[model samples]
Target: MIDLRSDTVTRPTEAMLESMREATFGDDSRDGDATVQKLEALAAERTGKETGAFMPSGTMANLVAMLAHANRGGEVLLEDGSHTLNAELGGIAGVAGLFYRGIHGKRGAMDPDALREAIRPVTRYHMGTALVWMENTHNRSGGAVLPLAHMQAVYGLAREKGVPVHLDGARIFNAAISLGCAASEISQYSDSVCFCVSKGLSAPVGSVLCGGAAFIERARAYRRMVGGNMRQAGPLAAAGIVALETMVDRLVEDHQTAKRLAEGLTRTDASLCDPKDVETNLVRVDVRKSGRRAAQWSADLKSKGVLVAPADLYALRFVTHRHISAPDVDAAVGAFAELWKKS
Candidate 1:
């Protein structure tokens, strides 16, 4: 199947698998794992941060970041559709004992004024706001790329209020490529950032959380508390290292393929969002006019040997990844055209 469901469906490349096979193992609990240490250092340097802690998933990374940055009963300001708030199973509230104040953002880019408004004044009667969270290439919003200026403005607001900012940069590389900038540029505005290696980077598994040394030291303890500690984790870290070193630059190709898919989908009778908004690898299409629910459309597409996702009642999503080549994109487009004509 031409799985356009999500970038997380990608598998490791042969080189990554070989690196994993050749990786040496050591005790991660004792901080004696050479491969894990190297991966952490590389991730930290890439993001211009003081240190990094590798975790099993992006959820764990975000949870650890929240736990490290905010005390129990503290509140966090976040975009309403942010992964940390909507997709991480409410880890902030459930595991970290933090409250969330959500503000709606346009096209996944939170307004600085809105964020400032969301922050609560320090009072003896209220739980104090502790952190501001944001996501780049926001998943629920069709992978919209959050503008760097917007992030900087939010960061400025947070700095003035003495509140920390944490970025759920799960697809920051995709945003960087779309914006024609370095990932570190995005990271500069965030006090802490978490990025996934298993998504567009094509690693089998892993995410890295980067921040100041003291913050990361605190996060390490949270990592263990969350059951993210791994012994002999070098094999996974090896794939992550290769993903960081080699896979980032290729995200532009995925963006291009998504653009192609969006263009083709729009040519059909199905109502779709702007193809120009297809800035990254995700294309969210409105299919209500096609007289099919998103779930039915997904099933139809799957039967035709193509795979996508039903994001909502009126929308379906197509996500391009490293495994989906240009030809696969063309085939997906053709399948959509055929299905639309028949429907």
Candidate 2:
């Protein structure tokens, strides 16, 4: 079956598996693993940060970053649709005791002007702002890439008030490819950044959180507290290294495939999806107009040997990755057309 459900469905490549098999191993919890250390340093340098720590998942990486940057009861400013606000199981508020002000922004990015106003002062009545959060190639916005200028504007405002900025950069590499810039160019505005190797990068597992040296040290402590510290994790890091080395440049192909799929959807039924909304590797189809719930459409399509995810009651999300070729995209589009006709 062609699984467009998510990029997380991608299996590791032969090269990635080979690296994992041949990787040098040591205890990572005690910082004795040479391979994990190398992956962290490379991730740090790639994102223009002083240091980085590898974590089991993007959620843990984000949680550690929040714990390190903000105190209990502090506030964080972020977009309403961000992964921190919508996903991550409310760890920022529940686990970290940090209140987040979710600002409504177009295409899943917080507005700079809104950010300036939302930052709280040292008022006894309100929890003051400790962090500003940004998401690039935002997931909830159909993979819309936040422009560097927009990030710079928000970062400038946060810096003026001495507030630290954290980026939920799970898809930052995709954003870089979309915007024709390096991921570091997008990450430079934030004090801390996290990106997943398991997502579009197609590594079997792992995410890296990067920031200042002291901040990374603190995050590592939180990582241990959250039960995220792992020993002998070099095999995973070895695949991550292979992903970074070989997978990134091919992301543009995934983007092109997604665009092709979106265009095909318009051919099936323009109201099923708007090709204009296709950005990066995510194509969010609006199922509301078809008088069918997103889950129903997802199930119907899956029976046709094409799998997709129901992001909400009204929207279905399809993601292109290393496993999904151009032919798979066309077949998925054809399945959608068949489903719509039966409706």
Candidate 3:
């Protein structure tokens, strides 16, 4: 089957598998595993941060960031369409114990003016803004990359307000590839950043949260509180090491394949998607015009050996990764085209 459902569906590479076999079996929670420390240091270096802590998933990393950065009842401001706000299952509020105000945005970028106005000082009548948040290669907006200028503006405003900034950079490498820059270049705008190796990088599992040494130290405590500690995680960290070293550069191919998929879908039906909006490995197809729900479209495509996920009631999200190729994209597009014709 052509699994366009999500990059999370990607399996580890042979190199990663071999590394896992040769990895140490040290307990990360007690004596501090050498392999885990190596992966954290590498992640920190790649993102230009002072230190890093490994987490089980991007959601936990993000939640730990919020917990470490803000007190309970503090407010977090992020783009309305961010994966943290929509897809992370409300961990921002329920687990981190923070209130969030979703700022108006376009293509996953929060308007600087709106963000500036929303930031407030603590008063008897109100809670102050505790943190500002950003997402790169935004998931819900067809994998749109936030322009550096936009990120700078937001980061500047937050800094002026004395609010810490956290970046949900689950697809940071993808954003970097699309922008022709290093991941650190994109991560530089925020005080803290998190990225997943399990996505396009094709690691079996793991995400890394990077920030100032003190901040990451605090995050490690929160990671333990949230049950994110993976004792004897050297094998997983070994795969992550291989992913960081080898999987990043080839991400451009996934971006190219995604663009091709978007172009083909638009050719079949203009209303489905605009190829220009696809900057990375995700394609958001508008199925509303087909007089059917996004779930129906997903089900229909699944039956034809192509799999996708509904982004919302009216949109379907297609993701490309190392497992997918040009012919796979064409076949998925053909399935979508067939469904379109019937509709």
Which candidate ranks first by TM-score, i.e. highest?
3
Q: Per-residue lDDT of 98-172 in model 2, one digit per residue for the tens?
A: 988899898877776777889977687987999999999899999998888899999989999989999999989
In order, candidate lDDTs are 0.91, 0.91, 0.94
What's the C-alpha lDDT at position 101 in model 3?
Answer: 98
Model 1 segments beyond 4 Å from truth? none
Candidate 3 lDDT trough over 10 residues, lowest sum: 152-161
Candidate 3 C-alpha lDDT tens digits along 15-128: 999999999999999999999999999999999999999999999999999999999999999999999889889999998889999999999999888888899989997789
Candidate 2 lands at a TM-score of: 0.98
Stretches of model 2 off by over 4 angstroms after superposition: none
Using lDDT as the measure, what is the rank order of every candidate, best first? Answer: 3, 2, 1
Clashes of each: 0, 0, 0
Q: Could you tell me which residue pairs clash in candidate 3? A: none
Model 2 whole-model lDDT (C-alpha atoms)? 0.91
**1-72 per-residue lDDT for model 1 (tens digits):** 899999999989999999999997998988579999999999999888999999999999999999999999
Q: Clashing pairs in model 2?
A: none
Q: lDDT (0-100) at residue 57 of candidate 1?
A: 96
